[model samples]
Target chain A: MATEAGDNATLKRKAHQGRPVSLMRKTVIHALLLGVCLVFMAPFAWMISTSLKPKDQLMAPSPTLVPQQCEAQIDGAWVAVDREADDLDITCLLVRPVGTSYSQVILPDMLHEGYELLQTVDATPDRPWAKVRERLPGGEFGELRVVPVSELRYRAVPQWSNYKEVVRHDQMKFPLFMRNTLVIAALGVIGSLFGSSLAAYAFAKIKFRGRGVLFVVMLSTMMIPFPVLMVPMFSMFKWMGENQLGTWLGTFKPLWVPMWFGSAFNIFLLRQFFKTIPNELSEAARIDGCSELGIFLRIVLPLSRPALAVVALFTFMWVWNDFLGPLIYLQNQEQYTLVLGLQAYQSQHTGAEWHYLMATSVLIVLPIVVLFFIAQRTFIEGIATTGMKG
Target chain B: MALKDHNTLKGLAFLSPWLIGFVAFMALPIGLSFYYSLSVYPLYDEPAYVGADNYAQLLWEPDGSGGYGDALFWKSLKNTGYFALLSLPAMMIVSLGLALLLNTRVAGLSIYRTIIFLPSIIPIMAAAMVFLLFADSQDGVLNAMLAKIGIDGPDWLGSEAMAMPSLALLSVWGVGHTVVIYLAGLQDVPASLYEAAEIDGAGAWSKLWHVTLPCISPVIFFNLIIAIIGTVQYFLQPYVITNGGPSESTYVLTMYLYDKAFQYHEFGYASAMAWIMFVIILVLTGLAFWTSKRWVHYQGE
Candidate 1:
């Protein structure tokens, strides 16, 4: 790992200092990269945009990335209004029956007997206005009123309430699920650190017959999909639960217990890193009559902290993003992780409650993105140089 | 010899955790799954010995009867295959393209790299939720943007033709991780090769095609294999976005296997399907390894 970083440092120097690409070429490349970056970020950007949008604006004919709040003069006061016209011209009546505080902008076609058109305002597209009307629903109605299309304002204030509401969603107990996910993730990381490192040390530093075969076997296990093991593992866990072997299926046990069994990917990464720690240090320790575990604890682990961190980061990510594992194992709603809770938030999705859903997604996604920014150097180059793992 | 014996004993002792885990958790479960495949193991009932019948029904049962065997099995497998065919190439090209772009000296290169790589690492489930908003027909951002250009976007996740492609977009967005892998490989490509190519009067395109590509072919190979392996188990999006609906156009193999096992309690059929999937993965990865001999070049080799 150290050697690779050294190589990259020299490589970065040469590539930058050597290349004399034309100014025109650099301009073209940067422009292209900027465009690509925008395209890449659009979904996430849209997620943040939608999460803040007012629920009414969610079904706008042409949605804007920024959430908007539009208000027009209604009943002689500037109040919230939804534009309903897809046209430049329409004959409408502004009506306020006696005793009603609000007024209604009614089109001629739907004009009722009691609601007579007191005045026929020939409302043009630009100067479209009716006498003081209602502050109400969206394009589901065609009542563009007192304020002109030009006069109506679109503000970009984010609705932070969506976050609050999504957290408070009845089925999605986000705090509870978050606690569940964290407990599971933290335990899994601890397990990986404990279990994978010990095994990786033996694989890298110890010599035993069939060790090569076992190492290869471990590498090949990384290729096996979760589906292949999903069924039998489920059956085993369920059986254990039935037999009172500490409640595997519904609790967090099934999620974290298997983590204690060293994973192929974590083991492989640690083995590579453990191989890098100089053998002379271990030989010196061995000559001092330090036991193998003693040497591993006293010398090897301290040097391999960065590698162990990468493994922990990766494990935390896997557990946090894991949908299928939680989907199958977690039958009870209260026991769900964030992923399953997000799934519950959108159970009846038809684009109606997208603001809430997006808010929940952002909450779930925020930690990982923040973590990446913090450890990006190690996370990027470490995973990059290692090249392949889960 | 005495020292070697002592080391070996300690080695075995240190590895006991993994060894026990392998035998009990991995090996035992794998063996049991195969055993369950040959029997009619309902969730509630004991396993009834029915040798080879599950396999026969899954492979040979015909005519969309939805009886003993689901004809949707074939449809789901085809969907998975379509996803692989669609996603794998896009992931490779886009990721490699981004990497090549990143490799060049640009201002704020780290920022560009970060932006490109960010999507790949976001929780897949979070990605699915975001895509749900993006692919939504009524008010999704994609269609809204499309409306600006006078192009009415199809219901991305709803329509039969557009569903898998919509999914491919989601898959492609996450290739930022792959780009980093390619970036590492590209950096490892010696500068001397490019200098030599430049002296030989190679144009930019020529240099990229001849010098750069061959150098990164091994990375390309590794990325392609992982992408293939990953695409075959395409689960999260379909399960979240579509649930294999709109005439089952997006029902991938893993979804069907999941439903059979957990939802419908057809554990035997699911296990049989799983084994078939395992074999398919082996064959595909094996084929990748086999084909690598011709295309993949090593530094020393």
Candidate 2:
């Protein structure tokens, strides 16, 4: 085309320029689109990267992101990083007695105290400073050059027992937290979705007196900040526990009972989706002697699968991640949800073993991440279909 | 005509599950919440009929402990409002931009859509943790990259000045839902209209402005409404990332209300907060709906 245009006069070249102009537009759009997509994806990329970095690298200056090669001292032999080790470093800050003159001490000499902080330099075969230099800050060329192995005050050791310690803590238990979270998430989702679906069906399909008023009223409930109701709901539940419903409903009633009725938000969403279905379909069913209930069950329910799946998935995610609700409703440690458990872990380990806490957090977030990965397509469809009104 | 009563009853019966749930969960809780807002319901004793004391305290009382003079409640409301104002518009623009991208005949368009939508499905708990990895102070990937460009990243989620904006930026990543809606709206736009504009010597920009904008105005309105409502109720990201931290710069209404109810066990006060929030959402939504008619072009209309 360029050769042909070159063979022609100036008029032909001018006409040929139009082709490139459209090409430029296409190129610009594609570039702009790629940039926007990357912006949308940056967070997940950051998350996965952070999850893989080693603890020392986590807080290091120019942290070695590609896990560094390190020698692990095992049975008096040097093992590589990620290699099995029988010995582990359990670094502890030994506090001198309050009245004593020494402010604080890092005890390398306390060999009989059961924990031995493994020195990386001592374990490496030759040029141990090279290994130490790689692990420590300032690298090969800075003020802090590696001293002889004996002079190093601190030893970096792995704490394999920390995970067990966290799980078995007396004030908090991990398994029970998992069980409670599962129960609450499962029940909350089922109850909220089922209850909301019923209410939504009414709002969407039924023609009754005050239907408009009822919908407005239902929507009005959305405006009431949940915190406003939190106090009343809590008191009511505690009161119920102490008196009337206590004899039968048990303490968990406050947490799960409201799900049977419906959430205004879910009802609103379901109703909107339901309205999209043809009214004539229901009318036809009625003409064929099908009851309204039959139409809802046999027709509306089946056709509304996409919306229902969305509602279920959303409800499940919310209930699973809910922190404040379970904290307020269930006082028993045995009844604590996964979020509460994380909070409890935060409280207990305010200063130490944060790596284990991070690990536990990974455990907590893993299932939801997996679920999201599985149902992500359906979830998007649901959100997009639900009407842009949050 | 005689069978109409029976038909209505049948319709009502189909709606019964929702009706019963509405009264039990939505209506009853809301009413009780209103009543509780008007009284004092300390956990250890009977709720005293304080009769507007909670409302008065929320609005007028200067005492730091209980009344309208309370700094925490006002602060949280202010913070929440600020978040909503900033995040809503940003979300709309970004989501629309995404819709424009996905609107093309890209190779593996569905794959791109799924990848873009992935974050929206991530439970806030997980995503928030992941966000912290990138937004963390000193050593996070974001700051590390910024250093290479000779620009220093602020302590993002940790800095009081930048915290809310950081949270807002985090929200832009999960706009796949809005994008999907915009894509649907964009697809609905008739191709002939663009063709007509082109024949009239309109450039691509003018064609998009005159034809595409008017066609998808309603979708924009829908996205706007949802964004506003969702922002007003914003809790999860701020709550998880900063823990409303760096000195409560990101403290939000829901979290403060949560503190009042569960942490302090101030039932009446929390209820009042919730009620105030409800009013705010109602007013905002009403405003959106009112303004929508002017800018939003309904296809049928």
Candidate 3:
């Protein structure tokens, strides 16, 4: 009985010990997961922070994730400064503090006008302080006081106007680019859905001669790299332009017109989804005297809403993000998509004005990110199904 | 029999749009591309037959004295190979590791999954722009962070040595799609095998090696071929970020091809390069498939 009692106590102790150990493990795992998430999100956070920075703050020697406004210590209270600059020779900055107006004075041997100071300083034992007569804010003359540059601090102030400036930048024409992208994406999505779904319906439902061979041929085309077709496609578009289309090279036609016919991948995806639906529904519809086109339109499409949504979302995102297509075809700035415009913006202003550049990038990426969040399930499922089957 | 004929006619009608597209876009382009690869056909000029000179120049020509020794073709191929060598393994390992961690019964798994998958959805152009800002030599976020640890960051896209690696690193950052795919593959791994391994006194490492690896081998193989193809055709990131600059360090095959076709108007040469890339991709894919029989495990086989 004593041994049994000892066994019971040990078992209870073991159970008691297991609780905190598991809790600790959970905490550790959670912490690790959080750390990984932060690493993954760090780029986006940096992009957001950079996008909100003003032009001047963007070029600061040490980059700050938060946009900052310079502040000066005045009358023992930190007051915001419109402009502050530290002289190369002196420790103090000539700051135009808030709540006071000061005139600029061109000092002797100074390249630019120096801001009038309020006080003067005598030479200190440790440092050699320059003595200069300067105009005060109230029009009084006094020696320049050397305030340490370290007294100035920067406070976080997001520049909301960066986005506005980026959009309004003369070279970018962001709004026009966005409109072009939307028109192309919308038309392309509609065309792909209509054409590919019809093809998928025929492949999935209707019995046809050479259907097997044709379907295999379509799938094999997907394996052919885009580079292989790019040259000839360009030539074909050029040929069409010469014959009738009137320079299709610089137009949106080359970008979206191809979609009006169909894409192999979309057809394959829709076909897969269509195959999963029981043929009995289509058969019954056929028995009900519905035409083949009517059966496809009414029966197959209605039942394939989820798959259709997947197709639409993927197509929209693909068109939105496509760079090579626009890069190859669109020669004029007016014809440029958002992706192409962003590239143009980058090349035009390389290594400078990153704030505006990042803002532009954010503008381009935000729509798709929002779309993904709204249709997360479809996006995940579409990607998974495609990867698995492919 | 009459109904069968009617169905066939209807099917043909339904397939007409795609059939026309296939002929106009795919079939014609491929045939013309093959022909273009053989002849010296500038955009404005009639095709003058060169008879495999473009292919020979790309494959064997060592000097421009023979009218086709840019040497960029071989260099770009090497650069692409280097990029794939570094990036493919890094992506697989990191994505698979993330997949394993995510496979655990962690709290808020969906949130983690979403956050990790977010980067993949970002447009490559946008991602390239963001990386360009991040990889700035002076005052870039990446370099600034590196300074905190007392290391000076190299000019990522500027220096010859670091440019390809930088591009590869960029590829690594966008491994979210691969991670999602691996996560799906991992979910398909039966729980019973893991339980069996646990009962056999296998530790976590052994269980992962014996049970998990075999189960997901096919998925890995699939991702591998996809990555290989993608790496070979890697154009946008380099095109946007480097423009194949800093002494042509980051120039890959597709960029070279684009420069040939668009910038230099060497349509015939570009077509030849495209054919070479196609053949390379096919061989690599075929090689992977051929080797898959030795290593890739299929369930119930």
TM-score of chain B of each: 0.96, 0.94, 0.94
Full-model lDDT for every candidate: 0.81, 0.65, 0.79
Error of 3 at B127 (Å): 1.1
Comparison by DockQ, 2 against 3, better one: 3
Worst 10 residues of 3 chain A by lDDT: A8-17
lDDT per residue for candidate 2 within A1-390, as digits (tens), equals: 001111111111011011133566667766776676676677555444434433444555554334333443434545323211121233323333444433222444543434333332232333222222223231222111223333333224433344555567565577788787777667877887777777777777777666778778777665555565566666666666677666312245566667767777678667777777888899999899997668888998898777777777887777777765766677667777777777666556542334455555666766776877787666655665544332
Q: For this target, which candidate reaches the highest TM-score against the unseen true structure?
A: 1
Model 2 achieves a DockQ score of: 0.40
TM-score of 3: 0.87
What DockQ does each listed candidate score?
A: 0.57, 0.40, 0.47
Docking class of 2: acceptable
lDDT of 2 by residue, B129-185 (tens): 656666777757788878889988899987899999999888887777678778766
Tens digits of per-residue lDDT for model 1 on A1-390? 122311221123224224676899899999999999999899989989888877667777778887886666556666655555343356676665545544566777877666645566567765655232244442233343455566666677777877887887776788999999999999999997888998999998898877888888988887888898999989998888788876788878778878887899889778877877888998899899997888999999998888888899999999999988898888888899998888876875556688888888899889999999899876886677567322
Stretches of candidate 2 exceeding 4 Å from the true structure:
A1-23, A36-40, A72-77, A81-178, A203-206, A247-253, A268-292, A346-377, A388-390, B61-68
* Candidate 3, B229-257: lDDT as tens digits: 78889899888888887788888899999
- Clash counts per candidate, in order, are 0, 11, 1
